[model samples]
Target: MSLKKLETLSTKLLLKNPYWEYKLDNYTLPGGQTGEYHYVHTPGAAMVIPVHDDGTLVLVKQFRYLWKKESMEFACGGVKDGDFLSTAKNELSEEAQLAARDLRQVGEFNPFNGATDEICRVYLATGLSKATRERDASEEFEVLRMSVAEFEDLAGKGTIWDGMTLAGWMLARRSVSALLKEKRL
Candidate 1:
């Protein structure tokens, strides 16, 4: 059976920004049903789990205007007109001022599957070194370091509620665990 959007019924842009656009995609569903997918259209994004050689992670706290408070999250940002690996390195350097020799692409996942088609690429970054730090005009954040065990505890206790941070960690940790299982750690 073939089910597809017969046509674009309409496109209404809710908001336009440099990185993303809030829009509605109206189409005919597979079963000849009328449907709309309201989602954020974006160039996508990348997240880095910056783990130190000793398994400590570098995290960030930033003031997100929508949240109206400093929110804790891992270093991540949108991939602005670049490949995932390049964006990952740039984000690592920009957010935490760290450059990594080992940047393993862990996996990819949709951050908000129901509402957005935004795909986030996750990476496990090790072999860290200092890099020149620069911030985007709207950026505001702080850096913090902690062990993986501590991070897991924090997540378990609901201290880490940022969707990107939690989701990115889940993917990256799976890769890390696989490495450990094969005695590759």
Candidate 2:
């Protein structure tokens, strides 16, 4: 069976944001059922796994207000328009005050498929340096570095709980290894 969208009965914008919009839409489903679907319309996002030459990974401690808890995650932010790479670079510097000497896209995934259209593009960044850290007035996060091994242990023990972080990590570990091999490290 092929699903088809006959038409959107109505589209009501619930919330407007720089990176995404929350909207409630009414439409006809594939099986001729008319229903309402509320989802996030977004320009998507970017996540960076910053690693040093010695295999140290950069992580951040930030309070996610929605969850009302501190979470450990890779530096990440939303893409602008359709410029994902530039957004990744800016997020790396803005969130961690570091720039990547070598950066490459490792993976991409939909953060929430059922309710949102936001896709997170993951990148592996190496050969890093310190830059100016700029935080928004509402943003507060602590940056920390740890050995890759320690990160693995923490993640394995369910300590690093952010889904996006794990997704980024899954893509980055293999790439980071290849990067180290190319550097003959």
User: For residues 15-131, could you state the per-residue lDDT of candidate 1 as single tens digits?
Assistant: 998889999989876677888778888889999988776667899888888978777788888888769899999989999889999998889999888787789999998889999
> Each candidate: what lDDT?
0.85, 0.87
Candidate 2 lDDT, 45-128, residue by residue in tens: 999999888777898899999989998999999877698899889888988889999889999998889999888999988889
Return the TM-score for each candidate structure.
0.86, 0.88
Q: Let me know the TM-score candidate 1 reaches against the reference structure.
A: 0.86
lDDT agreement of model 1 with the native: 0.85
Candidate 1 local lDDT, residue 112: 82
Query: Clash number for model 2?
Result: 0
- Residue 18 accuracy (lDDT) in model 1: 89
What residue pairs clash in candidate 2, if any at all? none
Off by over 4 Å in 1: 1-14, 30-33, 178-185
